[model samples]
Target chain A: MKPSISCKFNRFDLLLSLFVVLAAAALALFFLSHAGGEAGEVSIRDGDNAPYSLTLDAPRRVQLADGHITLVIERGGVYVEYADCPTQDCVRTGKITRTGESIVCLPNRVVVTLEGAGEFDAVTG
Target chain B: MKRTLAALFLTLLLCSCGAPREPESVQFFAMDTLMTITCTEEDLDAVHHAMREIARLDALLSRTREESAVSALNRGETVEDAELAALLTRAAKLCKATGGAFDVTVAPVVSAWGFTADEYRVPTQEEITALLTHVGAGGIGSDGEVTTLAEGVSVDLGGIGKGYASDCAARVFKEENVSGALAALGGNIYAHGTKSDGSPWRVAVRDPFDGSAYVGALSLTDAFAVTSGGYERYFESGGKTYHHIIDPATGYPAESGLASVTVVCGEGLLADALSTALYVMGEAKAIEFYRTFEEPFDMILVTQDGRVVLTEGAAALWDTSVAEHSYQYETINKL
Candidate 1:
């Protein structure tokens, strides 16, 4: 007589199969939640204009305020290369590479913020 | 058995897909800093209202704007704006409470240092002494209807303006019945409620020693947190670095043996003022002030000796596991 399909598999075999499936699901969930890493986008808000974004992978220079303010994005870092604003605080911010770091120009009303998968909602200092 | 396993896998995927939606965020520049407000999508209108409220406060409180009530007051004008008068009274009370460590009348000294004008300089001892004569909270007199400044005394609300703006934003959030929100007006932050997922908002405290890293994070809900540090604004002159926070007593940059001070309170304005006062007070006096203060508050003091000191209250909500650097952590309880 032919053995039934159920008879071929013991309790241990069934349990092993379940364990493998659960492990796969857990790994998938972990990656899904922690998807973004150092590779994120730079969001730039120039004055009252709507904010525009540029991927960190791209190397480029962005000019705002009629070329008075210049922003450079390269090598996974962003910085204010030159700014005509009186304070020049933006230029003094140096290069911001980590997520949630921002370069703010108060006089120019320009805020360049790094947006990535950060663990915190806001940073206080 | 295979069918059952398949069903379980599908169920797990479904659960993951049902995670809470992201909140709507609004970012704007105001009060000389970036302000970001985030709330549930349905409460977006409340965010806009909060922005308008902050703008209104900025107009009334800005010392730079010639037309602002504060500028008028600085010019020795008797301003009749009730809101301004109320804020001045509250500021004076905090100034007196902190034993003049948080005086608003330190504007002249701050200006002499050129922090407000962004033309950084190290004023001479005589110049600072001359400016100190104009610095005192007692010089401000308000009778509920009108407010006036003593001769040569000008008040700068820069220390408390952002914090008050956060308070105004909170008021707007409550008026609109917002379920949850986060308003970050520069260093002053207000975590309105839990996230959409019912988890406390995690706010990272920037490391005083390192700009790219954080010392730790605070899991906060419905709280106001403010941080004061010399690192925020500073300039180097003659081989010495001078920060923006000035000592009321000596009319110089506060040398309180502290790298930074973070104050968490139920009230925004208090948190803002106390952070500055505590920074100026240093470690020992700050702990003493915390214990003797009437209202309940928590503090995180990062000392120059590379120590992160948390009051008992702050320790309850602090998580230093993710801190970028390993520093000595100590918790101080009320005496």
Candidate 2:
């Protein structure tokens, strides 16, 4: 009696393997890039410009194109007290006390990032 | 032929399944602050391993924990941890070098100010004087692995634990095949390698008077920039401010005429130790220590009077253009 086993690698098998590998790579990439920030730091942007950082330790109102953004530092915390935008979403975002928290008003092109000092790639304390 | 195909498929699957992507980040709280590890890696395991190691050290070194090495000493027992022994030994050397400025046995004095307990209090002279007896690092006894402190004396590695944490993280980064990474423990920073962009890391010298503003920035790579500041952690009592860094001799907050001291060098532990030591040593003594130091290191000091002085070699690190607040920058020689 004789017994034989044969293995095959078809084009479809190769394509399927490639697809699986690509999908896994894509998923990992998505998650990796999404790992952004922590703490309470605010960065403002106007349209297509770069973000201008506003120190959370410094409490002051910022003037944007349309409405004004008020930043208040009270009791060792920073928050967006008021935004003159239409949706009021920025105000509703509440105070961000932890790392990686941010508030953005699309209408006013204002972005407030509550940057956590310790939760960064590199922090100079 | 068929075997090759199977092997290739297995390899692909195995690589895809367990491998973590590069530039992965991990953040957790340890050593009384947020410890972040951002590294170039294909697996999170290395970063996780680093975190576990650091957390273990944190537990072992914590003065507040009953099971910690220091706690063991406080209870008149000995410890047998390699890292603890090494830390205590190095701290002893630093204390001697800085004329007992960086004493681990200053724990009683530090805790007396309520910085450790979160209950701020100004200890009376009598209280401080009593605590000062056990203040110097001369009490730390180590024999290779096992170590002990003098009876009634305790140790606190807060002066250098974070720096050692950064060093441990850097080692893990290398073992994990991470090319470039940053390990930061509050004001203690270790730019393990250059940035992902292959440029030097820019670290700001925080304003000693204000947390929100920086006095200047430092360009560094493969270096640790650790700062000891009166403003880092402080409490106000009756219009007077008391900081966490205590002077062993006086049993009080150091009046070294320095608002903050930043030490930059290749070694994280040294930078951390030197920053604290130099802060307590003041400018003149620090310059002397610098001259006598075997290895090269740079220092940036913000005096209580608002003068910024850096070793001549340290100018490359400080970016005067980036400071939000104006500082009177002074360049000092190796005197």
Candidate 3:
């Protein structure tokens, strides 16, 4: 009796299936590790004047300006830093970087937010 | 190949459908006790240290100051300290803002009334009137870092210390990357950010007459709420109750119609000052004062008759159970 094509094909199929299983396992591990270490990003905007400027501080920067006044975003929080406005209340208000936290320069109309960490938790399916 | 693709897609869908992460609850200490912080570990430590620091400041600026820096100032002495300078500056600002309603220089009156460290017997009207002579913030003047007390005037931060503590703790929490936190120091409470549930922090105002029962719970985000209740630090003599929140002008306990006045603001100092200010302003003028401020804030007034009136923004969070037997209050903004 001659060897059937089915038997030859079964041997090849088993090796292919094993390869797919190993690849899936590797991908799943990589996905989980990345998810666990993800950090959040928060954007702070200076809300004044024509072509208002925005300062980002997830990295770092000094004085940034568009037109009317120069604002500064350092470390994580944003501040008026330097302004031509009287009272300097915005500068006195100091830094704010937490979520829902802001140093509004009512005069300049700037709002800064400290972004929350952890986009999603393990218990929220 | 088709079968393999189908299996791969099925696995991917299943993995995606699985549960995500759940946030861990954080805890800490404040309000003169062990307070659980519902925040990160670093934030927890920062808040704890801040509270201790505030308490130290209180000891230095307290109405019952024996060895406090303000006491030294009362004795006509000059001191060089950063905390003292900051507290004095804020104290002066509060005096100006509240029209002397929130005077830190009212320590002599507080002491004469037996609300001080000795907790002595209540004094005669004559004694209170005598001590009032030297008890005004105007007596103290500063040129930048140099603060000089005029004769016998003393400073007390008790009316505002707890609120300041809450402010300090909040400041540290924000600095240390705390997402949201609520610090309650006695009757003074401050909350920041949305909760882990993505809702604003909810705080309950306890009834002045009954310690166990709450009058109502008000919800706020990134605001400090302080209550100046008639029940706080009082003594009864001849069927008359003498409580804290004394009126500076009259040198007597504020005769406001409300049992408690709660003021909410961005920081504890303002909340504290406003609470005292509103209590002294009485209901009619308090409403007027609330509208006068440029910044956005809210207030809840619990009258002596058990009626509740909340500012426009805080009216939405009135929990009927806590405010049982109380009627809803309309805000000036609504009118």
Model number with the top TM-score: 1
Best by DockQ: 1
Better of 1 and 2 by lDDT: 1
Largest lDDT belongs to which candidate?
1
**Which 10-residue window of candidate 2 chain A scores lowest in summed lDDT?**
A116-125
Q: Which of candidates 1 and 3 is the stronger one according to lDDT?
A: 1
lDDT of 1 by residue, A1-125 (tens): 99766657788768766775676677667655653457478988888888899988879999987798999998788998999865677887788887767888887788888876567788899
lDDT value, residue B259 of candidate 3: 82
- Candidate 1 lDDT tens digits, B83-152: 8889999999999999989999999999989998898888899998888888888899999879999999
Docking model 1 quality class: acceptable
The worst-scoring run of ten residues by lDDT in candidate 3 chain B lies at B27-36
* Candidate 2: regions farther than 4 A off: A1-121, B1-24, B41-43
Give stretches of model 1 more than 4 Å off: A1-36, A84-86, B1-18
The global Cα lDDT (0 to 1) of model 1 is: 0.88
Query: TM-scores across all candidates?
Result: 0.91, 0.71, 0.64
Give the candidate order by descending DockQ.
1, 2, 3
Better of 2 and 3 by lDDT: 2
For candidate 2, write residues B179-294 as lDDT tens digits.
67777676688886675657666666667776556688787778888988876666777999787788778988889899989898988888988898899889889888888888
Interface C-alpha RMSD per candidate, 1 decimal: 3.2, 11.1, 15.1
Q: Comparing 1 and 2 by TM-score, which wins?
A: 1
Candidate 1 interface RMSD (Å):
3.2
